[model samples]
Target chain A: MSLASLAPLVDAAAVGDPQEGVPLALYLAVSGGLFLLGLLGVLTRRNPLLLFLAVELLLNSANLALVGFSRYWNVTDGHVFALVVMVVAAAEVVIGLGLVVAVFRQRLALDVDQMSSMKG
Target chain B: MGERIVFTIAAASALSFGTLVVTLKEPFRATVALIGTLLSVAVLFLLLAAPFVAAIQVIVYAGAIVVLFLFVIAYLGERPIVEIGDRLGRYQAFAWLAVIGLAIQGFVVLATTQLPGVRDDPKQVGDIGSPEAIGRSFIDDYIVAFEATSLALLVAAVGAVMLAKRAVKSEGGR
Candidate 1:
């Protein structure tokens, strides 16, 4: 495409204002990057606590995307769903930490691969 | 332009603090970083025009959840961590490669889209994400799901108690 046709796309990236709100794709980029970083942590970090923290990151990324879409569409549905996600995340952390405590007590080891009683 | 600057700062902090959450080895340090990321995301929510959600994000996610993490960290205390071989296991190269690929793809999509043009005029659209709107939805459109979340939280609390207690009881039996 000619630069004449692509000017709008370039403008869209820079048209940041409170009244206009942020572009949806920029939020998506942030969310995607956050998700990737969390994925890296989950894959690489064997510590269950750290793994849970990474999972939190992953969930937060999802929330950010949901809110962005909600704003883009000018609706509250995305906000509601984001709240649901927050609740689920809290529950997940609670249960996860409980399991971590239980498992860590059984053995002082921290690496999750070693806790493969059910098999890794 | 003021909003844009704040959004830029919030987004940057969210990403950087998120990186710290993953990279920090100590649980407490990672959790502190996680709070920074969460608050930044909360500011992002405000910029998105969801003030109610932004408040809840801070009160519930940052305040409640991070406190839970802190309590767990305190209860568990610190322990020496042994190095696991290969770090990220056998797929280290593949994982980093995936990260790079996704980054490039996301950047391309973001660069090409005329997304800002699609955004509605906030003044004409009215308050779509106000507390009243969201509260109405929770009761009218999503009552069942909202109730289900409460049930799920209750179940999770009971299950955690049972699971954590079972471990100690089994240890006593031994």
Candidate 2:
């Protein structure tokens, strides 16, 4: 009934023999490193388009971690979640770029800091 | 042997190009670096035995998304807004230090945690990430969520079109 009770069944499919597949820590390191790069980019970059790219990097890093854990646990959930995230990303980009195009059509300032027109 | 080598190359390339994507000032070059990062990550997916995800990653991410970025960049023709000589500020230094600290904490966690089966059974995860399994999940337990995603996508499509469209009538008919 509960998730803890399902541990045995879940572990049956998990990365049974760790000697064969890649090390889990290595994957985690790479994913975390990429995520940091993305965070740094988002923090430091001013260009909105560059910011979008950094966001993509962040999403990809999350995906990598999901897949790694999926393989480690031998489950389908992570794959499905990552796939759904990918689709969400596609939809996000469409709207984001559309908004950018519409706004830039009026006044083409590409800086993220310059878009704060909703002042109180 | 082969597996470790491939993983190293893939990880190295993924990080390298990812760094380039964040750091590069040129829009065109940054986009290309992002493509490289996507491709490398896809390869890593393949190595992780998610062949279906790897293929989709290539097809959807590298093939479609990056190309869409390229098209938008080309059409906009607006130069990257990052200026020379004054790019890095105190804010950037603070960000760098904060991220490095976060990275160190994360690395510590990764080093200490124990996996369920480490060097024990030595069995491979077979076909879990295959299309069949994923499709079953989409239709079975995740059916509602999957259908909701489709509806959201439809709305997003229409919304994107509406947002990008100019009001010619309001502007006295262009």
For every candidate in turn, the CA RMSD to the true structure comes to 3.2, 6.6
Q: Candidate 1 DockQ category?
A: medium
Worst 10 residues of 1 chain A by lDDT: A1-10
Per-model TM-score versus the true fold = 0.88, 0.86
Docking class of 2: acceptable
lDDT of each: 0.83, 0.79
lDDT of 1 by residue, A1-120 (tens): 232544553465475523545556667878998998998888778888999999999999999999888877778899999999999999999899998888777765777877767853
Backbone Cα, N, C clashes tallied per candidate: 0, 4
Which residue pairs show collisions in model 2? Answer: A16-B122, A17-B121, A17-B122, A17-B123
Q: Taking the tens digit of each residue's C-alpha lDDT, what string does model 2 give over B60-125?
A: 999888888888888778544434343346567899898989987885665445565532332577
Report DockQ per prediction, comma-separated: 0.54, 0.32
lDDT of 2 at B109: 66
Candidate 1 regions exceeding 4 Å error are A1-20, B79-88, B113-124
What TM-score does model 1 achieve against the real structure?
A: 0.88
For the second chain of model 2, what is the TM-score against the true structure's chain B? 0.85
Residue-by-residue lDDT tens digits, candidate 1, B1-174: 667678889999999999899898789999999999999999999888889889999999899999999998898785555565644477667878877887777666655556555433333345777989999989999999999999999999999989977988868953
